[model samples]
Target: VIGVKRRVHGGLRFTIPVSPFDRIRALKQECDRLVAQAPPDLPVLFEQVLRFERMIAASGVDSVPSHADGLASNILIGPDGRIELVDFDGAGNVDPYYEIGILINEVFEDEKDFLPALEMFEGTPRPASLRRARLYAIADDLAWGLWGLVMDATSQRKDVEFYRYGFWRFIRCRAALERVDFGSYARML
Candidate 1:
């Protein structure tokens, strides 16, 4: 990757796009939709949520370092569906859970199925397979929750609804944590 700096009247210049921010907002909407349709089996859901929370908490605490952004747009595909990650701006000192959360949200948004992705990551190491993805969902929710709050506080009234939606996600994540089988994820912590 290349980093560039521009001269601005004898000063340095830096520029950032608004797309990442927009992508973050879009991902949150997708996550909310999936969470609303999450299966009623509280035990399974709790286990998933608990696993995700542990991953997010650990990522935030710097236990592991992996690309924190795992969305369809960030994925570059080759023939036969081979793929590679294209963006790493949000990739520092982050939890695998946040990436999982984004993946879950995207899969659900596209296929309306969370089980397949969930199964894909099952039995994997903490922040390595499904556990990491699951954690991303929680971390993304938390991160977006803060983002939403910031938008609201800044008088971005159009984003208020999104912020509230994120708040609900945070609440659901907490509920999931409460219902999680701690034994499953405690080792990672």
Candidate 2:
């Protein structure tokens, strides 16, 4: 990663080419029933996330540290045009790649959109980080999928979209799991 000198014109990173069809505009559900019925794959994804984090820490990149939640709304562009990352509510010392992973997955949402954005941002893309991002993205999908089901079951918000959303997330998670050779990526741990 080239050392970036923060200049003014504070930019809030914006993703391009996101189709309206895939957007999850609100997170904004059921709690108990969904938890009880959550899929087994979610737990597997969590275990993988732990292994990925461990491997990333040992990869030896000078980490800027990880902010597990890199949601777009959490970032800001200062009035003076400087990039600002706020909301350190649960920030932690973690593999730097984890933060990028969160941001990339959040911005790209669909797998189809990831490569182009990655290539543009990274210039030529680094295998280690790109692979790591894959791990994180997979983990995120599983996590959100479970959360959606839980919220759908527990929340009073009677939107059937919650159920559909959970189903969609799980579908993506399964597809991603099939897509990546995580066993190879695990060796980095």
* Best candidate (score: TM-score): 2
- The TM-score of candidate 2 is 0.59
Can you write out model 2's per-residue Cα lDDT over 6-39, one digit (the tens) per residue?
1111223222322111222122123332356656
The worst-scoring run of ten residues by lDDT in candidate 2 lies at 1-10
Query: Against the true structure, candidate 2 has what lDDT?
Result: 0.55
lDDT tens digits by residue: candidate 1, 1-189: 000000111232123322222444454455444444322443343345444444445544432344445556876668976656667676443333344456676546532254565555443333334444444455454546545545544454683475576476566555545544555555444
Clashing pairs in 1: 52-135, 59-95, 97-135, 97-136, 98-135, 98-136, 100-133, 101-136, 101-137, 121-130
Candidate 1 TM-score to native: 0.44
Error of 2 at 106 (Å): 1.5
The clash numbers for all candidates, in the given order, read: 10, 12
